[model samples]
Target: QQQVKQSPQSLIVQKGGISIINCAYENTAFDYFPWYQQFPGKGPALLIAIRPDVSEKKEGRFTISFNKSAKQFSLHIMDSQPGDSATYFCAASQQTSNYQLIWGAGTKLIIKP
Candidate 1:
């Protein structure tokens, strides 16, 4: 889908806890999925992604669980740390397209001490 909608607009988790964020899309043509993590004064970097072809993808403490039939996906942060607190964005796009990402409104994650 062309639109990726994310929720909880903001999240607060204690250090060493698990943080979860969810997203949904309307279009199924979108073939590429990526999550970007952004910190203050810095550009978002590709955190991790999963295509419709895969059910889940994980990178270290970050995991992306996707549901193609439901047109939804979620990000799970394990052992969240204060340093992990940042704005996370869920994105989707078609590989055939020019790589224009349809982004979520942005979820601000804050880990409390």
Candidate 2:
């Protein structure tokens, strides 16, 4: 019930196109959902997030669409760029577990120039 499943293990997008990555979880106890972006040889960094109460959250070119009832969420990258090429991970955390994040397998995105 604590697992987050991600899809499209790898994606290729033309520059200026949109890149979308999806994830699903089975744990209703999860209260915090955050997406992380990681570059090679570096730790992941918070990209965007949404609470169970929020349907959507956007930051710059990144947007997260959440469906609390469906236990699903997706990340959309607007105007994808080569610089945006990286691995993305979706994670969930609950207040009861000391806020430990249960992670989704990484999605590797490549923006073709």
Candidate 3:
């Protein structure tokens, strides 16, 4: 329940397309969910997040949809761009943990021109 596991390792999307990836967790105690975006060797930056209180959250081109009962969540990118090509990670943590993050293995996204 403490780990968020992602899949596909990598994804390729054409410009202006949509990208989607899934994640699941075993720990129901986790309440905070966040998605991060990283470019190259840069540190992951928080892209968007949703808590158990909300079913979804969106920021600009990035969106995170959550399912509390299912213990799953997903990240969706709309209008994929070359600049948006980067690694994405999903994370989980409890507020009581002081927001310490449990990260998913990074997913490399490539937006082909």
Candidate 4:
């Protein structure tokens, strides 16, 4: 079984600051990396992500980057706000795995005003 390891079990960011979360995968077979954000009382929502082929992706205040050589990917929340406080997860998926995502442990992020 493949595994995705994430760093920073928890994080604190000031409002308007950038929040970064990282994930590393063992198997190169993994092709896609997606970032998800979960609120205190809501299910996870797809934040941003992309295939490793692109190397990087950016949407609004969020960005996802892939490093093929390092077998790693990361999520960056730009100008993070208080509303951005949530639990973040990094997941890797492969077509061969029936699109089942192997998830990282998760990071709890808090944004201060």
Against the hidden reference, what TM-scores do the models get?
A: 0.96, 0.98, 0.93, 0.97
lDDT of 2 by residue, 1-113 (tens): 87999998999999999999999999899999999999999999999889999899999999999998889999999999999999999999999999999999999999999
- Give the alpha-carbon lDDT of every model: 0.93, 0.96, 0.89, 0.93
Encode model 4's per-residue lDDT on 1-113: one tens digit a residue: 49899999999999999999999999888888999999998999998879978988999989998899999899999999998999999999999989999999999999999
Cand. 1 TM to true fold:
0.96
The digit string of per-residue lDDT tens for model 3 on 6-93 reads 9869999999999998999998889888888999988988888888899988888888888888888999999999999999998889
Pairs with backbone N, CA or C atoms under 3 Å apart (clashes), candidate 4: none
Inter-residue clash pairs, candidate 2: none
* Candidate 1 lDDT: 0.93
Off by over 4 Å in 3: none
lDDT-wise, the better of 2 and 3 is: 2
lDDT of 2: 0.96
- In candidate 3, which residue pairs get closer than 3 Å at backbone N, Cα or C atoms, i.e. clash? 1-26, 1-27
What does the lDDT read for residue 42 in candidate 4?
Answer: 94
Q: Candidate 1, clashing residue pairs?
A: 1-27
Candidate 1 on 5-80: residue-level lDDT in tens? 9997999999999999999999888988899999999999999988899999999999999999999999999999
